[model samples]
Target chain A: MKEMFYNRPKPLHIKGRVYKFGDNINTDIIYPGKYLSITTEREEMARHCFETVYPEFLKIAEPGDIIVAGRNFGCGSSREQAATCLKYFGISAVVAESFARIFYRNAINLGLTVVIAPGISKKLEHNDIIEVDLKMGIIISKKNREELKTIRLPSSVLEILSAGGLVPYLRKKLGVEQ
Target chain B: MPTIAEKILARAAKRDQVKTNEIVMAKVDVAMSHENADVVIRAFKEIGLKKVWDPERIVIIFDHRIPAESEKSAATHKRIREFVKTQNIKYFYDMREGICHQVLAEFGHCRPGEILVGTDSHTTTHGAFGTFAAGIGGTEMAGVWSTGEIWFKVPESMKITVHGKFKEFISAKDLILFIIGQLGSDGADYMAVEFHGSTISEMTIASRMVLSNLSMEMGAKVAFILPDEKTISFVRERTKKEFTAVLPDRDAQYARSLDVDAASLRSQIACPHAVDNVKKVREVSGLKINQALIGSCTNGRLEDLKVAASIIEGKNVHPDVRLLIIPASRRIYLDATKAGYIETLVKAGGLVLNPGCGPCLGAHQGLLAAGERCIATTNRNFQGRMGSSDAEVYLASPATVAFSAIKGEITEPC
Candidate 1:
């Protein structure tokens, strides 16, 4: 049993204060297009994230804050900065009813944690303490005693996440990034 | 039963079959990019690759920020040009070409059964040609450049069946907007949406382009309008290269299906800040607009220009509205000029801009100020998409936009 457990990775958990948003929060609303040509750095991209829709998002944002959003979160543009901005801003994870397809895949490719929990948006308030267990596929709302089940991530996605995004994963597979 | 996406993806994967949710390293037919090629270049350099896998299979068009809107854009374009020259890429188009998607189809790089990946989301527009096209991040695109292959999780298929004839002024744009409204933004999340039925069958290649372009709004991984006579004819005009068409199995299993009655649908507008926040044109008719734009990858084709010209001919644009017309490509621009569409539009007080994605993505051209509103033929209506966060954009068809440009407000054609 000890030998079998030696190689098992630890379960990943994220606990943070929630920053809530409404449905169909698109990539433009997350990272406006005007700044695309200017900001080439992830840290620079983080500064402009949600600056258009929520003007004070950057000012009030803190490390380990999680975004709780309604359905179709991150829709519209396929800009990966929308996810990168949040990730670099120290957002631990995004818990939403759903995510736009490209943005969801971009997040996974970037190793930014994203969780899908139906009705999770309505259950949490701004600044509510929430905990998410990626391995267990569950979310616990500290505001209330109620618990919510999250969509279990596919094993392939889990593999990519463990490898720290597609770039690093490809680096390893190509045997280049020593 | 396999869908068009599955068939193309399977061939690219070189596998007997693939199932939904299964990851496969499918080979790429073409890697497309725009001004964002600089970003891809940086990622490629980070991957420690001195040369791309295949120079012939990469397509770069300087459409998004053509003519270098600012110092930043100019620098990015310089880097992109340098990279293109050094790589000896043949399919690269300069600032005067047009939108990436439109140019790709016009030049015959996109064909049925081929797999295309790009750095822009609207890359899905190529699926009008029945290609397995999807958008990826810059890093992922860099991987494709290095390896000529990318991974895909086969998506569940959704069939959208359209029937009945469209009423006058109810173009393909209206039908797609209606579908997006019904499906919501995430309705087709992680799924391949296949447009089928009589309406799609009768659609021209340009009209089918409108449907596949806006399908991105519904969170589709890839959108498809299967090959038909119109498609084959269109492909024949562009390229002499032989290619095979991939079709969905007769009994292909779709996880979800929808029915659209085109006859009953009205002219629709996606209101401020959301593509799915759609309503019939009558609901907000006469609402004042300051700018009326009739162009973008979504509706900037020659057919769209002809429709707008037919509507605005022999009439002046409203004094309050700035009516801007931009054709999708230089070829379309020349064709429109040959057909007198540009003359009718300009004579009617419309400003004909250069043939590119001018001001569509809010990088330059006609950006609205605070408290202003625009009626555009562009795909997105997201908040701040056109300029100021306080400004609003209502998306409609070219006919609706032209009609509204005359009225300086949102209105359906009488």
Candidate 2:
């Protein structure tokens, strides 16, 4: 039997600088539909991610950086590229007050870590170093170690995320060798 | 006490009953994709899957970029065709077929009490048939393609009951737009909306389709119009499949309930930039428009086309405005042509395109330039939804769109 390498959640104290955004950060801004015919190449998409809204987003974005945003983050379209762009660019996780329904599903489907942490954005400042415990749903300020509570994901959703996404989870459940 | 959505979802999940907030693995009766099939195919391959769990349950439709607009699109079509052939997928519609939602409806792929998932957001249209249909991402679709099942968090139900009769020129489109405006865009976020009462019951299948289709406008996960004789007869004429009708129990709990007097509503519109930014037609009328489009899964049905044609018959499209007419499906297209609706539209200077989702996503045909404004019968008016980010798109009924096309600006239908 091939032992499955699961993305099991632990107290992932990811240390990263915060890149803050506002409410209703739509998918169109994240990944424009104009490029649907071009390609969904991760690097190319990452380059253009948030291009119209925040020019030079890719240039400013670094690996292991966290995205903090206000209400209804990822609020437009069911395109997985919104999640893919951020995940491909090595975004540690997206911590938002809330998320659009489809964007939330797409993010989870893509194995991109996103948490609903109400008022987390208000507590965050630009470039604030932060540590997030993925399993426990806690966000701590590395500067002051001040903790913020995030809405805990259901056990079922946690399983899918911790398995790296639905695909790996299904594969393991079906005993399909990768 | 189960809501209609819960009833269908529980049956699909093979459970006695499933409540709101519960998670369950439900077998999908149908999984759908359009030209986006290319994306799903790629994602499926990336997952290292060889064969889809059930080819018969998979449906691939080519409506987004039909007739191969570009080399990239043509190549994508070739890939989807090859995948369909190799997998022996049973349901596949080429460019000639109308929109995916229409195709699913005419083919009876989404029967009552069934579960359907698609890559397009408007997949919520199937909720008119009492099916638990919702959109998913291409990657998530690929996962369902592999597993034949997908996990769903049973959403809480919101009851929207409308009574009374409609005024002149009012349609399901107007009612839904009014509701969206009232509820705001995120009112029903992550919830199932159950539409009920006499007004909804009197609506035709196509009209009901508009209600369910635009439910997503308010962020509803799915919308249900409980199956009635109209639904049964419509499904019967389309397919002979025996299916159980799902209905909400009398005591079913709702997260919230809203009441609307349908008879009191007039023509409504959603203004620029957001689906929830709505205004009464008279309030924003005569705002010069450059184009008018009547189509999309939302309002491209034959009935909608008939309404547009009736208003535009013997009338020339405004010299300054361009009118684009797209049928939701080839069946609707052919029916409209036979009924002379197409010829009337053409004589009015309306350009009838092939039966596909043309220009709705701003992919091709009828794209707008900066500083231009358009009134579309389709749902969603989010900024840049039709073309240039600077262009404004307004959502309205077919009658409104056709009349506005003749006036060269937003106008109330006679």
- The first chain of model 1 has a TM-score of 0.90
For every model shown, what is its TM-score relative to the native structure?
A: 0.95, 0.95
Cα lDDT of model 2 by residue, B1-414, tens digit? 889888887888999999789888898888999877777887676566678999888998888878778888888888889999999998898888889999999987878878889988788898999988898888889888988888889999999999999998899999999999999877888889999899999999999999999998788899998988888888888877788888899999999999999988999999987788889999999899999999998999999999999999989999999999999998998999999999999999999899888888777888889999999998877666678888999999999999999999899987
Q: List the residue pairs that clash in candidate 1.
A: none
lDDT of 2 by residue, A1-178 (tens): 2332224442245678999998767777777766666444666667667765477777888888999999778765677778888877878789999888878887777678888999998899989999888777899998788999989889888777777776666667767634
Runs in model 2 deviating more than 4 A are A1-11, A38-40
Interface Cα RMSD, each model: 4.7, 2.9
Model 1 agreement with the true structure over A36-143: per-residue lDDT tens digits: 886367778888889987888989879899999998888888777788888788888999998887788778777788899999987899999989998899998887
Cα DockQ of the candidate 2 complex: 0.46
For candidate 1, write residues B1-414 as lDDT tens digits.
899888988999999999888888899989998887887787677666778999999999998877888988898889889999999987889988888889999999889989999888888898899988898887678778999988888999999999999998889999999999999888888889999999999998889989988998888889999998788888889998888989899999999999999999899999987888899999999899999999899999999999999999999999999999999999999999999999999999999988788877888899999999999999988888889989999999999999999988898976
C-alpha RMSD of candidate 2: 2.4
